[model samples]
Target: MKFLKNKITGITIVLIVILVALSPWIIWHFKPDRHLDVLVFDKTVPQNNYREHKGFIWLLNSFKYTKLNGDKYGLLDYFGFFPEPNYKYKIKPLPKDLSKYDLLYVTDTYGVYDRDFYGTSKNIEGERSQKIYGGTQSSEISSIKSALENSNKSKTLIVEFNSLASPTDTKVQKEMDQLLGLKWSGWIGREFKTLNKNNEEIPRWVFRNYRKQYGKEWNFTGSGYVFVKNDDTLMILEKRKDTTKDMTFKFSPKGQEDFGIKREVGYYYWFDIMEKVNNTESIADYTFFLTESGKDKFKKFGIPTSFPAITESKIKNHITYYFSGDYADKGEFPVVYQAVGLPKINSLLISDYGNTDSFFWKIYAPVMQKILDNTYEKKSSETKTASIN
Candidate 1:
């Protein structure tokens, strides 16, 4: 009897250990695959590198959203990055009938540039990616409009930064702007940790363009913010002179509740300054903690100290979200997404202060999850109502 009892105790311990070890995967499986008919359009794909939409793809996998192609997650559904024998780089045409898709997520329309294709390190295009497969094509814009119209205002469209920026024809851009009720300021800016050329963070074209325009050498050094207009106008805000602190991305009360964001997060990346038009609501904004000097400089250039980071507009039944920053551009966290608790652990281990991925985990992930969840529930409810009718 004693020997049998001891064996039972050992077996119980082993079983508990196994269960604990498999908990993350088990937890992951319990979450239902929402099976959303999502269409992700990322045109910036160069080679097999999926940096532009990597984080978004991971979210799709995490949410278990079935793409329009019937697969859980695959590059096949993307309108861009399709390589062929004749053309190694070119954005594949979008489908004309997009009404079938429940969600149209445009992560990066910036497209593959010459530098991106050949690689920046090679100096092939002299720092200019030079729009190759980027910018919103007329056909693509038309399809998006068709989708919105055909869906009877039920479709959701989410467009991220650089979608309406330079390289995209003004006429084509105006179509989207008019449709979505947004006005692009024709300027994009980003923060730099250092202006030292040795760091190699500053793009070569920036220096070249600055020199060409001003006919002077690049002399400024140290951390700063750089802004460039569509017409090639360049302005720099050095750290001590312009900004007292780094920018913070904050969500409005409505946004905080809607997106389930707990608090503000550090924002360090490319962001465009935009003015809301046609009753568009600013859901979130980037607050640049600028010095008096910085304020004057921005004012002189007709730039606002604080600009909309995320904007939302509702057209009839259709809802649109414009993320004025490169929101979806981030490194993929494979293991972090696989396990349930890994994200929390990872967040605790790393400092969110300067880290870019922290924003993905803290702000982007939860918000995206909420969007997917709400959309799934709403769609499911509509289906049930339709069946009953």
Candidate 2:
């Protein structure tokens, strides 16, 4: 009887140990971490109203391969503030005890809360707020500024959606200038109100007209120029009106040299002429423009345009070109775009966070990988110095 009792006790102890060891994985199976603490401040819960919610969920699930284990990861919804461990609560003032978190993310809806209270311990601030069109309440630029200033512990990455409201009204421009001055790495999200979805022939005609006036091909090469810096590459597509006002020469006849002909030039007229010449709808086209520096960088890499074409070399390098719309549709795992407003924001989050040879591991892994690597490197350097001494 004594022997049987001891055997039962041992089995129970073994089972408990196994359960403890597997607890983290078990909990993670239900709610996995994307190596990020997404604090959604939007008034909508589960972001059901926004189309991007599906894409967001998809993005979250794509990280399952990483299978990172930890309690440090979760989502906080800041609509009606309450601390619910099961459902990441949205608290008004960020908790002072954020030492445990490595990254913090803020989305739309929460722009009204006091950001200064969050105390900036985050490494990334993904801002997708744009000016409220019609009658919507736009995200506050001051809040973005406060969040950036407070997050002094590490570099803060801002993902601004479209044009920030005029700098005169808000301090967003000032904060942006400061960030640029600090040499922080960042990118801007430019959204186009209209897209060219007509047949290829129409696009070709538009291209031809653009080339005749600009002395460049209107295809990928011309379009690519907008993202290129120098080389007189005007890749950006301006509205026909804007382009005519900026690029065309007005004709006037006051002297014999000018002939007896005078013509008033309007921007759209040039586009109309092009369309007539090409037998197409309208010649006026719009395109997103990158900063001069960004364009120059693209030129150096031979990546001239934003069109989605993956070359063999790029594929070898594991570089993938993602179109804004395509990314919104397919990038997220479970499709969160339906819940979040994917159409409203034109942005992409590119990081080697999930890549096998990720930038994060390249930059931070050596610090802890085999303490001997650090020890040996330190000893070897010290020895060389000693020899010199």
Candidate 3:
């Protein structure tokens, strides 16, 4: 009798400890303060990467609940979360319903993988899969554009990261111009000048030497911030520094020139796309401050850099148009678009654990936070207008 009692007590104690260990999760799961329905579409959601992805999602989710009043938030994962819980997490596969959700969060890489999987795989047929996987197809781009434009509900917002590829062969420069009537220089022969902490101009040659040591071509031109807008409203904020220099023309300079060569310097431009949006203007109204040390480092290294930090008042002002780079180089240059804004979305894009802690995050998160806040405000205003009518 005594042995049986002892065994029962041990089992009970273990059960109580297990419950205590899992208490936080249980509380978080069942006692959400607000209800928010968010959809995440990514192919690697079930892998270890999902944990990091969830960190961002949960950050946003917690912020949403704290800022907005909601008791229930519905989350849908397309690729699913790893360490698959014993309990279902309301997972939905492709072709599932999306109309009921309040917001959709999509990563650009997810779209690319989906296109290759469902669109290229012969196992599936018809245009349905193709439509879902918007690729370099006109129809797909148009479809996505239409969907975004139509999602005007005050409660719905689309937070997209690193997903702004031209749907067809049309470059983003051309597409942005056509879609928003904003003229932008291509990524070449641009110049970027750095300033010291005292706001004094750093010698241009300093950047020149840095570019050389980094094996970058010397063709650089002018570098600065490019602002775009429609009807006096700021739509896009592009802060970039470019370098353009001339070197001796090499044999087959037209094709053999490398990004590091002076001849190629005139042919290629490096750019980083900081923030893009529609309907809002004037990034100046927001408090703008880039880490002074980072700026100083760029100057010390003679690297071209641009930082967009503005006062809250500047954000409300209207911005008309902006330009970045435009140069012609051999096709070997790293795709400027691929390199730009990489750090801004690294948690979702890069597989390496080291990238998350990289400098990109340090500089980008604050900027993204400001942009997201602006977007949320804009969405709220639009919703109010619709509701009033």
Best model number under TM-score? 1
Candidate 2 lDDT tens digits, 26-60: 65466533333333223222222332223333333
| Cα TM-score per model | 0.90, 0.29, 0.35
Rank the models by lDDT, top first: 1, 3, 2
lDDT of 3 at 169: 41
Q: In model 1, how large is the Cα lDDT of residue 39?
A: 83
lDDT of 3 by residue, 1-389 (tens): 99999999999999999997766556555643433455444432322234324433434443343334454232234333222343223333333334444444443322322332333332122122232333233333343344445544422322232223323244643453343323222111222232222212322343444455555643334333222111111111112312122211121221122111111111112232333344422232111122455355445533333321111111112112221211111112112211223334453453321221321233223333443454456555766788899
Assess candidate 1 and give its lDDT. 0.79
Q: After best superposition, candidate 1 residue 165: deviation in angstroms?
A: 0.6
Candidate 2: regions farther than 4 A off: 1-37, 40-57, 61-139, 148-171, 180-233, 236-389
Candidate 1, residues 208-315: lDDT per residue as tens digits? 899998899998878888899999999899987888878889898778778766577788889998888879988888888888989888888899888888888886
Cα RMSD, model 3: 17.6
Q: In candidate 1, which residue pairs clash? A: 111-134, 114-129, 153-317, 153-318
